[model samples]
Target: MMNRARITRVGALAAASALAIGGLTACQSGGGESSGGDVTITWWHNSTSDPLKSLWADVASEFEADHPGVTVKVEGYQNEELQRTLIPNALRSGGGVDLFQAWGGGEIKDQVAAGYVKDISDAAADTIEAVGPVVSGWQVDGKTYGLPFQYGIEGFWYNTDLFAEAGIDAPPTTLDELYTAIDKLKAAGITPIAVGAGDKWPAAHYWYNFALKSCSPDTLKEAQSQLVFDDPCFVEAGELLQEFIDSEPFQDGFLATSAQQGAGSSAGMLATGKAAMELMGHWNPGVMGGILKDDAGQDDATPPEFLGWFNFPGIDGTAGDPTAALGGGDGFACAQWAPDECVELLEYIESEDVQSRFGEIGAGIPVLPAAASSITDPNLQQVLEGLQSASYVQLWLDTAYGPTVGGAMNDGIVALFGGQGTPEDIVKAMQDAAATL
Candidate 1:
């Protein structure tokens, strides 16, 4: 596999890397068309909550209204379940799913290899071109397999009111400072950070951030291309994670907490002011708002007025560039066997109007270069500013490395979080998985 290092900026949206891969078995779809010439394409995505959930539903309706005979059966599922199980099973059987969430990276590459995804390069060329290099992750070789709608770096989403109550003045810019803030928050009887350990990926991201700060850009590129992890920095990432875990900054019972499931999940903790901060992505504000809406049972639910964001603090001494960031986007792809309407629906989803609405509501960073003006949300604006200043931006480690190796890596990282694994274990796990490929 070639190193997909070529990065391009899509207006304000930064270019991000791709996702995971896996071999899949083939079968037939449960349904796609009726005998009367009516087309029904099933759409599956990870936005079971409000805001994004409603946005997607409305988009589906608009698509149906424009195309008289076409029906889009859109549904939202939990992210992990959708990405890890349902979609893969549907694809393996060639049933149920027509258009589904496609996180660009090694994941789509594997789907392409299995001949399960449509080559949308021709069908959605205009939208792809409009999004520019930011769509890099969703492409395989040189062809587009999927298209991203949300792309931005991960950072600390904090409750400003809680920060003030804890007597923390500003966001930390270095590891030591973050530790100090953590101490202050703890002294003030507050949980400093919320990690959804039960989900694995959320807790695993701590090591991902540490690796971003510990490894050099060249080392990361070489490792991804060669699937090698001999460098000591990889182990140091786990060491740093272990130290952070030792700090015990997360809330109690965090190991079983879901990331965004309900009012008790990680995002829910931050949304309800039960926690001071959460390390999450640009789309988190939407997730938080959706959580609040669900928990409060009110239509006027919005992200906390005192919500704030800051980049993950840099470690004082590391080979990794302090300016490097970790991020990626969410996109969609058409099943290889789906009707042509599948691609048309993708076109509508990435259209300027739809993308603009995405930005306006803080669902995520819109991919369209022209949709930048629609973002009035201050937190997302801060994220874009950080993206502009970042000297390098890496896709989420689990995503950039693809599924097989990334899965092993996360497993090891989560083990460390639970005090059952060591720093070396995580690197070894990744190395072992890479060896198979």
Candidate 2:
């Protein structure tokens, strides 16, 4: 197994800059370097650990085998580090980075506008055909620039034992019922929802999903493209989300907990019967699995039995359908200055074989439906089924909005949780931000 921490060794092929050693002359080939028969292509990503990193290496090796004599130098960075330093630095023309990953939306779209990335429509035609409409999510300006690679949808995770103990018959299917369920769980001395407001992004998720549930996909799409924030749908969504937070369903001190701390704490609470539910993504299975395994010693190690999930229920009589989903995920974006070898590398990654391998390694859900059939992991299968049930899918609010829109939503959410803002106050802030955008 490839340890994710060893990415610098196996993932990175080029250092900060290329060097010219004495008498070891090298010419710039299609991907970047040409020495003998080696075609070194610079590939960058943000997945730096665990099964996700391991799966990527397996795919890279397969790609190498498919194209004899071509070696992909897969470089990786930690999520925050990549966004803050590596990506900005790589944007300089001729930086030796041919391909990299980005959270698809304004960030990548802005890159497209700046001419920093390539339009891979023709190169990815076959992939689009094989991957189906799911690939369209990454398209911009009538051009397909990247592949919808690894992805997972967001939803609510709950403790099955807690539900049974509270005499809850089923997971809530509507907001009213959801609150009722929460009340029942609270009476049993368990927090109904576990929220980590400390990490601004996690707090942002609640507001984002609430907006998605109240708005139509087309309206949200328009808002994303134009950076519009004041759309009535947004106000309605913000208000809905604020009400949930105000219900006092989250555990005490949730407002003070950081996202990192909240994730483990929330899962721990569920496992030890401290909380009944958590809003999370499919990737959480691995975290939950690791925690459960560690809690049980050696031969006695087994996953907790109470773990399960449900989509965040929809608001009744709202414009949004009950089946709409909110999601955020990673995808590849080609540098506009990329050489042929770099483009070829992307084509290879999008192929059915590579997509199928993604599932086998347990790296969340593969974006391609055909690839979903090959995932042998039962838990991932459950996740895929849940995703397929959605009537519509909305990009995560932060990824879908400009920094201003996202920031306002994040601040409004934190303020609401801290008891310093009202539903009207939050909605007004969102509307004001959208108006400026």
Candidate 3:
């Protein structure tokens, strides 16, 4: 359980902070002269933190150094804002930026359909062979549009200290044991788990994880594509999700809390020994290390260590293994309206050396296996191990559903949490939405 903030949560008007974090040296207005080459590319991102900033900047520098005539003007956008306005502006005015980051699933499809994103299938195919899973997940309509810049394996992140205090030997490995452990933690006067349902995406994680464990990878993929919510597997998954939420294991005020607040609360709970576990991603290390340390005014030289993780366990009777993971990340995208120079810049961002440098900063798991192996960080190694062993990887539910229907799923989950709806009702709602899409 790491006490950290996600850059993706930063609102749209907060783009100034995002850009500053990128550390772009060159400023290019609509008609600025390039230092050497006549080509200048505009790059946009959604990262405002160190590793992501350093990782992307490293790639940009490499791109400029290698291609003497081209320069990259990078801008950072809040993830939420980027989807809201930047996309429309890109499609209409085409002045937003030449390249931006995008999630691979339904968002990619929607953007491509809107005529805002370029078709990089031909450009990405050969390179994807080298990058593997990073690129594999980005493909749509038999074509690829972007290269994966980052990846995180989805699973439960737990607190070892809390586990020991509760006399729980290890993280649960099956559905029954999972419930038993939650009850044990509850008996010990601790919240069994910390969750954020304020943002539907986080709540959807549970449902999707259940779907992942309940069905074959192919079925999940089809469900994502056809928007088939009525599938028995998904219904079963929804029922399980309701069971967890309806039970008294979750922390108080969970439904009333916002995503950011819940994350901070969860981190605090774990860091201070109040909770046993949380379900989160790899990006948490920086958050917990930075925010919680300062809150206590402890010596800057040494910070408390209170972090650990485990993969999401499988349902006992499910065909999928516990090691099965959900994998997806943001990526640099080439705008269809962008000039060739911009496309070139994006291609460089995916290069081996550049990607390796990104890994050095721990911004993300390098999509290229070779580059990922070059990273020496132990936590990153843990994430890499999770990805490498995953029998099958499921993409984020929001990513898979695209925006419109995904939003609906989120609402349904929130409603489920308030006891206003049933799991079958929620699943049917999503399935109905899927049928139209």
Least accurate stretch of 10 residues (summed lDDT) in model 1? Answer: 3-12
Write candidate 1's Cα lDDT for 319-378 as tens digits: 999999999899999988888888889999989999999898788788788998898999
RMSD of model 1 against the true structure: 8.4
Cα lDDT over the full model 3:
0.68
Instruction: Point to the candidate with the largest lDDT.
Output: 1
Off by over 4 Å in 1: 1-26, 29-36
lDDT of 3 by residue, 247-342 (tens): 767778777544333225565555555567767666655444433444544343121255666777778777555677986887877877666666
Q: Of models 2 and 3, which has the larger lDDT?
A: 2
- Candidate 2, after superposition: displacement of residue 286 in Å? 2.9
- Ranked candidates (lDDT, high to low): 1, 2, 3
In candidate 2, what are the lDDT values of residues 174-278, reduced to their tens digit? 888999998898888777887667666777788778878777777777777766555677777767876777688888887666432222556555655677887
The positional error of residue 395 in candidate 2, measured at the CA in angstroms, is 1.3
Off by over 4 Å in 3: 1-40, 58-71, 121-126, 260-274, 293-304, 319-322
